[model samples]
Target chain A: MRVASALLISAVASGCSGNQSALDPHGAPAIHMEHLIIGIVAICTVIWVVVMVMLGVALLRGPRAAADTAKSEAWLAMTVVAAVAATVIIIAGLTIASFYTTRDIGVPKSDALTITVRGQQWWWQVFYAGADATPGFQTANEIHIPIGTDVHLRLESADVIHSFWVPSLAGKQDLVPGRSNSMLLRAEKPGVYRGQCAEFCGLQHSHMAIMVVAEAPADYDRWAASQRGDATMPADPDAAAGRGAFLAKPCAACHTIRGTAANGTTGPDLTHIGSRLTIAAGLAETTRGSLAAWIADPQTLKPGNNMPMVPLTSAELQNISAYMESLK
Target chain B: MGAQNRLTERTIANPAPAFVAGALLLLIGVGALLGWLRQPRELRLDPPAVADLDQFRRMPNGISGTPPESYFALGKPYETDAYNLSQGKRLYTWFDCATCHGDGRGGAGPSFLDGWWLYGPEMVSIVASIRDGRPHGMPAFRSRMTIEQIWQLAGYVQTIGSYTPKIAAPSRNDNEHTRPAENRGPAIILFDEGPLGAHPDQGPSP
Candidate 1:
């Protein structure tokens, strides 16, 4: 029993230490929260132990048959004093921690990048803020930000309520339907972190995940620059046929690829889908096979998703997949 | 004995106090229920839309008494129910109709809430247009949405430019776009300045 208890305790302790964990924070806000959680857990454990010890003592030593009045009064006064002291300390600590953390986290920096993230039913419509000279480009699912730079996200929902939560980076903020909310995120290190729609949205909520790729400033800029360009035209005949098939089919009705007739906005923008890390709202790998399968039967992969199953022939599906692969 | 002396046991000894407390709570609950029941129904803020089948009778296709081919063969389901209209509105947004149609004011496609429709102002015509997309723009949705959904959308579309019974008052959180009143004809609205100099005979016409 002792061995099993030790193992279980270790497992629980290590569970929140993953790369995408709040306990293993990579950003300032997450770090603060992690400290706060640790402090709370420690204080609670101590309190529990003290309470248990008192219960044990009380049980082991029965109440006095004839208690001395002065001694009993002294014990009562001690207990009350200790309780009041603990309460005051706890309240002060919590208030100070909350005020500091709330003020610091999501505080916009002068050089912070502003991005708009529109939460669809099961996908993210991500858009970088446009400069005066350059129009903003739209992408889906994956968000690339510069490492160590504050990133502000304007959260909006195209449909139901969804939450933006990157546990290692920042706290969760709800994206309510028909209203816009904002949250700030920053990554201290250059690495990939998984994000999820923290809200319990409709079907396929588990599949509605996102990836945050924190790259170096130069790399992020290069990615942004490349993404701003229209989807590259496929040179291969099969890919060309795929593009043709895409335009000819109902695919064009709900997706958009810049510089093509497939300007649909009901779904996520596919201008840079080929270059993305994952597809189907981070549910599948970004591969030709997965892309083809997703296009063939979106309903199967994500039931109740807005993208209906488009009846495409096998050859056309392959062609479309090729064209999609050649998009970058 | 000392501990017992220090602490005093409290009990509800008076029945009057208990009865009075219970009565007050009951009265408050009854008052709240009555107030809620008497509250007036809120006005709906959805765009004015009415799906009347009478408009279809004016069409040549309707006069011939021959049902049009493809989806919505059973004819447009005149759905004025708030829930159904909201569903149709969701479909319209989901289908990305707002992209080309500029939130009901003309953009790449002609405005649905404006005068001078390229196709006649019949619900059936709207259904047909959606089924068979026009040239230059307007992607066909026949393969995507179900016929029932198309009919619902047609019902919602018909509501534009028409008065509707208010259901709920508009809230500040509502982000749905409302059509501007000065709905310039499609040509002007599409280009933002003047009509596209394209030949009037191009593609289908009203």
Candidate 2:
């Protein structure tokens, strides 16, 4: 009995709160959504109970006789009229509430911090626009924002359609090819909000996750300043040799490592790759081991992704992963 | 009430015919869905494309230099296959065709969007250009790519110059890309601005 009740309680509360659950609202837009959800569900529950009770009463009273009184018929007509009126009024109120909530989510102005997000096969390429004359920089799979600030995201796709949805921050918006779409992302508290590509975009879509890091203004500024600079030269001898190997191989032709000759644009820029929280769009945490594993065999870990396995010696692989980790 | 009760009793007594028919319909729908979903994410058009090379002869221009009329059909099988076209698109990126082509706009290399073919938009000609290399610094990719891969690239290249967008034309990344992104649009958004190589003996549009 104890085990069965424990299982039941866990199941019941599983979706009530979590990192990715819509029910756990942390931003203004989501709070509005939560309000609407609670209001609608509460109203519907009350109506359902009343309906069931009325149904039971009618069944208990039995079927009416063939010759009904005029007074009884009049009462039945009045009850139906009241029910129809109530339904229309309730639906109209809900519609009005929804309309206002959607419109009031956020209207981004030119002054808001603008970030351009490009959805690739199974990852996100994020570019942070510079403030004043600070100069912008790019990162993959991670976005950083200051709490209590309005973030304007210019969403675009590199290939197919993908939707950006962070249930804790904002509603879902699609990134369509050949055109640009915009969305407002904001947070009331400092925390990491998880997001993912909510569209069916080919084979590795399930692994296309992103994280929005909300921090204090001073912390965000410091982080952005560090990102704005080029990658630091590695102090370790192994990492320096790994850099030489990376530029010598085909990796240079597809990726760009700033302050170096690796200016290829076929893949994500690895300028500040070490600073990112996760690699391969949240496939794994950012670690030397995970980076080496991903580099050695991308097609196996995330099957059908565009990263083809380039044959690497164990030593070269080690040096490169170390070099990547040292970029921070 | 009595009539409705009798109707419910009749359905409960004879359920097999309706159930069997419903099951068969559901099975057929599932079978079709499975067929589509089973398309592997690997290259499937490469083998036959390699087989075509035995008869593959090419004259770059449509005149005496052009190959026989059968050469036109080399790109037919892949022209409308979305899967094959997308594969060719990927190869276009991996090979760094944009270094000179500039997203097929022809910066250092001749443009593919002008609808003006130095050689006509034949798969054979495109393959020859890729494998054997063309004039004015066009490097030969013969040593770099397989015959099958070359054909796939050729098919994608031919579509870049098409005036009417083929429904099967490959799609590209949606970004202000650093280099050649030929498949950026569903079809060629043509502009006659890229640098043209001096092909003094160019023929009319075929």
Candidate 3:
């Protein structure tokens, strides 16, 4: 019994707090949302308890005399009216609370940093708008934001509908095709908050995970500066051979590696793929082995996806994986 | 005892065997329909190259040779086949044709729904357009995709710009309701149930 109870407690406690749990909020918007959720739940619980108590009292005091029915009818009518009024008031209260919460969470400021996030079938294409002379560059899957700043996101979809949701940071906003939607996201704590496509977007939806890295302002600036530049030429001979292979194969037709002749728009931009925390939209941790495995057989890792299994020699595969890892 | 039995039987009507059989048949019908709707994944979904594919070798300026006349007409199942069209549709979205083409509406490229064929509405021209690419912004997909895959894409493209809606065209995506789906005919100004004169989706025979 004790062991079962301990296991149950651990299981319940596991979901109470995490990088992606709404219960443990780390941002102003999420904090507001959490408060609203808790408030509504408490209100509903109180109503349920009162209803159960009344039901218990009525059941316990069964078989009341018919003699006092005339007097009780008026009392019963008044009680029903009061109950109806209470229900209306409670519903109105919740509506107002949620309206205010949504307003507070979504209203974007004029000067908020605008980043256009386009949702493809299973990946995210992030384009940071240029500020002054600093030109904007494109990155895939990962979004980096400075802590304690409101960054406005312009959400759009490349194919089907996709929702952008980071439970630890802000509310969920959908990315619809042929239409533009915007959301303001601000993270108070500097941490990696994981997010996934809330909507079911075809076959690889579950593997379509994203990471929001909230860091110090200086650190964010440094990361952004690095991401904006072109991919450096491979210095090592193995990587050079890999680069040659990537260009010669169909990889050049789908993916774009900035600074190289590979300029294709079919797949994600791999200009800084090595710098990302995860590969294939958080399907696996970004490492040389995982990259090689993915390059070898993308169809197996995430089936029904666009990435075809390109035939490659074992040596060619090793060099290509190394070259991909060195893109950072 | 007989009177009592009659009274009980009269009070509650007993289910007829025909009714039970009809209900069972309905359930079976529903199960079959659902099974058909949710098409399960095939064992192999990747593009396996054809051994002999001498297509896309030479032309004036990237226009490949036309598919031979006796191709699918000779016992080969293609074009009108649902499986072939579905594979083509898969290649259509996955290869990012919708990126430049804007889901057949044509963003950077010409619109397929306009009924204006730049290189003629023939399947061979469409095949050449895809494999060899057009003169301007279009990119050749010879290296990336297989010949069968290209043919499938060409077949699907024909259905997109088709004057008459084909039975093999698949449904719309799982997202928000946009324009007329492949199954549905062209939409009106508001959307859906378009005018029947020129619209093939809701034609006179539909």
Candidate 4:
């Protein structure tokens, strides 16, 4: 029993904290929700224990005399009154929490930066909105936002259905085909939060993951500026050869690399693919070797995906992989 | 006792044997209909024809000392059988080839039924058009579609105008890469679909 109590306590402690946990409450919205959750749990637990005690009393003491029967009737009436009072209090508490949560999460900010996230079959296509002074650019899989800033996400799907969910940052929003949904998010501090498609989309639905990078305002500005430009040109011969090979082959057919001849919309944008943390929708690490193997046989890594096995010679693969890595 | 007797007499009037027999016959009919629907559909139509395939094969492109052969070096990739054509038709729709090609009558591109050639009238040219897509319009499918799939699509395109009523795939024209209903496996085939029959480069119908 001691060991069991220890285990229960540890589990509860661990549950209340994690980098990706909603209960941990990294930001204002999640923290607000966390308070309500804790209140509800405490209230429910107390009520449950009281009801169980009452049931035990009623079960243990059986029939009695006439005077005892009259006392039992009075006890029953008191229990009913307590139950009604508890119900009213619980209902009032929940109603206030719901309204407060909505008010905190739904209030839109005028200066919030809008990022359009389009969900595809097994990947994410991210596009940052351009303002009057700055031009917008396209990236994929990963999104970087400034810490403590209201980040508005305009979610849509190119095909099928997908849900964008980052437990630490905000609530889950469904991306339905032919329809656009919007949600707002704000990170309290600089950290990387993992996210995934909460909806069951298709075969590789499990592989459809997301990475949200919360950085300092200055760092985010620098990153955004870099992404706005074309992929840095390769300096060396082998790297240049890789670039040529990428353009010559059908790699351009489904992928787009800004400022390069490889513009095809069927696949993810690879302009900043080299800098991504993971590839194949977070299935593999983003490395030159992984990229080569992915190009050689994508189906082997992610089955039932639309990416065909690109037939490339070893030397060509090496060069192309090098060029891809040099995109940063 | 009276209630029990009445219940027993009613049950006797209804009769379990006749009711069971009727239900059994109904089940048999349903099973037969399902079997008929699931049967493999076969084709009785002639395969699409190509004019002067030999002449096109003989012409050298001057580079690499190797003559430009068809993508499917093994004569015909499929047997042009009913089952194969039906799969090919489904693949055509699966790959969204109908989006620009108008199911073969041509939309953004030229009509395959008109027999007019922007590149050439040979079968190799058609395969080449798909392999390395034509400039400006057709997207290069070499990297996106497997070789066998390309062959299947080519076969389906060849049979476009052969029938008056038109042998067509079900139009699922959406951008979704739908799983083929026939369970022919993944949309992409990495391994060889079948063994080559002695490398048809030597002659036709090896």
Candidate 5:
């Protein structure tokens, strides 16, 4: 019994406190919900213990003589009423709290940043809705947001039903075909938060991930400008060769690269791909080796992914890797 | 006498049995209530950390039919030396047909490998399907694949349209000249469902 109690205590403690590294700079809503849950659990535990003790005593003491039957009946009635009342209160409180936390929090009446996310089979397509005449920027996998600002996302699906969830940033929003849903999120600090598709799409669904990078306003503007094709590429022989190979192959048939001959709208835009921290929808860290591996055999890394294997010689792979590395 | 008998019966009745039965019933009722209360609240019960829920939603709509007998009849001695059905297998994957056909069992789409063909069993009808496409959701592949490739793909289909994987013939050697005669599986045949057993004209029927 002592060992069982110890194990239960440990489990409760660990479940209450998530991975600190993962929860750092989490928005107020998530933190608030966590505390509320813990409080509810503590109260329920106390009630459970008291009820059990009372039940044990009642069983051990045995029924009193016929004279005490009225008192026993009254006690039983009170216990039932108390349990019912407590359940109602707890349910009502949780529902209300969950509603307020998920509702739009302090979104300014002024124009908000609007982004559209389309969930495809095992991938995410992100499109920035630009103001005025500027063409909106398009990207995949990685999402960037300005720190201390409200951002609105319009979620949709290309093929199946998918859900967008960034546990530390916001609640999940479903992406359904032929319809769109909206969600609001903001970052309190300049840091990176991980997100993933919270819907099972296909064999490669696990590989679909997104990086939410919170940057300062100025840094965000710079990144946005580069995404608009204002960024210049370094004039290196290896990178140049890699660029040539990229344009020559079927990569151009699906992907779009700003300021280059490769311009296919079927897949993600690679205009400023090098600046992103991770690749393959957050399946791996952004490195030459990882990128090379993904390009060589996407199915091996992310099974059932749409991207087919592009046969590249070892030398060509190295050259492409070097070129992509130089993009940042 | 009747009143005395009733009093005696009441006194002889065993109270323990009645108490045990009542207790058992109460226990069962309480257990059921506890089970109901333990159910998880409100949250969607899908698997955690799913990458693409969209893809999963779309898959169920495809491949909704029953599997055909031809798939199960593969590799038998009588079934050998028949038409090469490999073309259908290639077509199955190429056209994303498996998405609906689903391993040849009718799922979202009608089962082609089965003896029953909604249109007709004739090659002309199948070829027409390749040209015009079906009403529900099947797309015409005329614009997508070359005639030669389609014919080759169709040739492969003939041998294995009902070819279930369990009794699949051993992989064939691609080189025709070097392969031994005994090793060669079957003679490729192109047949028309209609009277003409030869290739038809390209133009649509008037």
Candidate 6:
């Protein structure tokens, strides 16, 4: 009995230790799943041991005693039938229970915030629908949500199929091309949770990562408001020269900087580019050096990307990079 | 011995075995009931339609249709002379194709000097590619460069595309007559100051 107790304790300890990423073990859904699994396993283990012991005793005793063949046959038939029936009943019950649980946790419609997530080849474009229900602030790679609030995401794909998955917050749902799928997520605590593109799109797909920052309601509101506001271009002479180069070159042909005349929509908006955490759709760390390197040769860093290498002298490249960094 | 045998017979004749068998059967029935009770109840919000052969047959492949041929054939051909080829070489350096394609020998893309054509060996295909684009990651150059300049650039590319340098040994020159035009310098310069010529500020010179 002591050995059995020790074994049981060890088993549970190992199970608890094994799941490192299970932040919500005490949460209702996770707890329910764990309880069901443990119960089934325990019952099955007891049955197996009892049956094996009985079979061993029978074999050792031999057929010297009266056979009672008919009675034995009846028992065997009953066991087989009972096992099959039990299996079917268990499977059906589990399926039904899971379905109901999922339904009860269905997306909350009342006062739910709606955000549109568009997946491109190697990036995530996030758009928040404003309080008035108009198209609101747009950002990339990072998604901010208020803690303890239900947020609904309408997932869509711009070019190919991609999946939005932030394991700490909710389960994965695909963003299919030309169609929108909905998901509801609510985080209980304030922290940064990581997400990745679950679907294979193209080159740099593996590099696509997103950050979900769960913030206080006030902080989230401030961030959203700031993103919605116009971009501020620097008035310094070098920056002005850089701006000229940006407009004169092919930069304006693809990227859109909202308050300026650079309004080509082929690439992500760079109005608030200085505030973004990463560049090249989360492929590289957003810094002066990395950003300049990316601008100089995007294909070298992310092979098989749509952005071409624009010709720029070293000094001009520096000026343009500095100007972009000043936008925050 | 007679008494012992009678005792054993009496024990066997009693309801002991029957009681044990009945209890076992009852236990199994109870176990099965418990198992059934423990199973999860599936609540499907949307009940599935009854399975039918017709439903299976109606499924359609939802892939995108093939791209149009005109979309692929957007640019005209270019012709380059030796002087323009030299200038193009300098322009190519400024453009940074060498970073990925290597110094004349290709790395990420096929070598410019190699005759093997992944798309097409002809100058028209090259020009179209420079102007329109390829599927994987090639950006369309129509917005970036003029149509005529792209053609001339294609001509310069062709020159490099067909070139094979002569070996160090003079004996290799014996087959010079059989060598392709790409092996020699560019034939002619097909420069048209590119499409920007339409802009009064930066239009092509007469």
Pick by TM-score: 1 or 2, better one: 2
Candidate with better DockQ, 2 vs 6: 2
Supply the DockQ value of model 6.
Answer: 0.04
Interface root-mean-square deviation (Å) of every model: 10.2, 5.7, 3.2, 9.0, 11.8, 17.3
In order, what lDDT does every prediction score?
0.73, 0.79, 0.81, 0.71, 0.62, 0.64
Query: Candidate 4 A-chain TM?
Result: 0.92
lDDT of 2 by residue, A35-100 (tens): 888998999999999999999998999986757689888988999999999999999999998898
Question: Candidate 1, which CAPRI tier?
Answer: incorrect
B144-201: candidate 3 lDDT, tens digit per residue: 7756567778878877777677777654565655567765534222122325565543
Worst 10 residues of 4 chain B by lDDT: B43-52
TM-score of chain A of each: 0.94, 0.95, 0.95, 0.92, 0.85, 0.80
Per residue, candidate 5 scores C-alpha lDDT tens digits across A154-180 of 899986899988767776778998898
Q: Per-candidate DockQ versus the true complex?
A: 0.09, 0.10, 0.21, 0.16, 0.03, 0.04
Candidate 3 RMSD computed on C-alpha atoms after optimal superposition onto the true structure: 7.8
Cα TM-score per model = 0.69, 0.72, 0.76, 0.73, 0.60, 0.56
So what's the TM-score on candidate 5?
0.60
Chain A TM-score, cand. 5? 0.85
lDDT of 3 at A3: 100
Off by over 4 Å in 4: A1-17, A68-75, B1-100, B103-105, B108-129, B132-149, B152-206
Better of 5 and 6 by lDDT: 6
Error of 5 at A302 (Å): 2.4
> How does model 6 score by TM-score?
0.56
Task: Name the runs in model 6 displaced over 4 angstroms.
Answer: A1-66, A131-135, A235-240, B1-206
Per residue, candidate 1 scores C-alpha lDDT tens digits across A237-273 of 9999999988887788678999899987787888878
Please estimate how well model 5 matches the true structure, expressed as its whole-model Cα lDDT.
0.62
lDDT of 2 by residue, B1-206 (tens): 99999999998978988899999999999999999885344433233434455256654442224433443554454455566677677888778888888677678887777656776677777878887787879887765555655666887877766666666646655456553344443234554533544444563222
Whose DockQ is higher: candidate 2's or candidate 5's? 2
**Candidate No. with top TM-score:** 3
After the best TM-score superposition of candidate 1, give how far the Cα of residue A105 lies from its true spot, in angstroms.
1.6
Model 3, runs deviating above 4 Å: A1-13, A66-78, B1-24, B27-140, B144-148, B154-167, B170-206
Worst 10 residues of 5 chain A by lDDT: A16-25
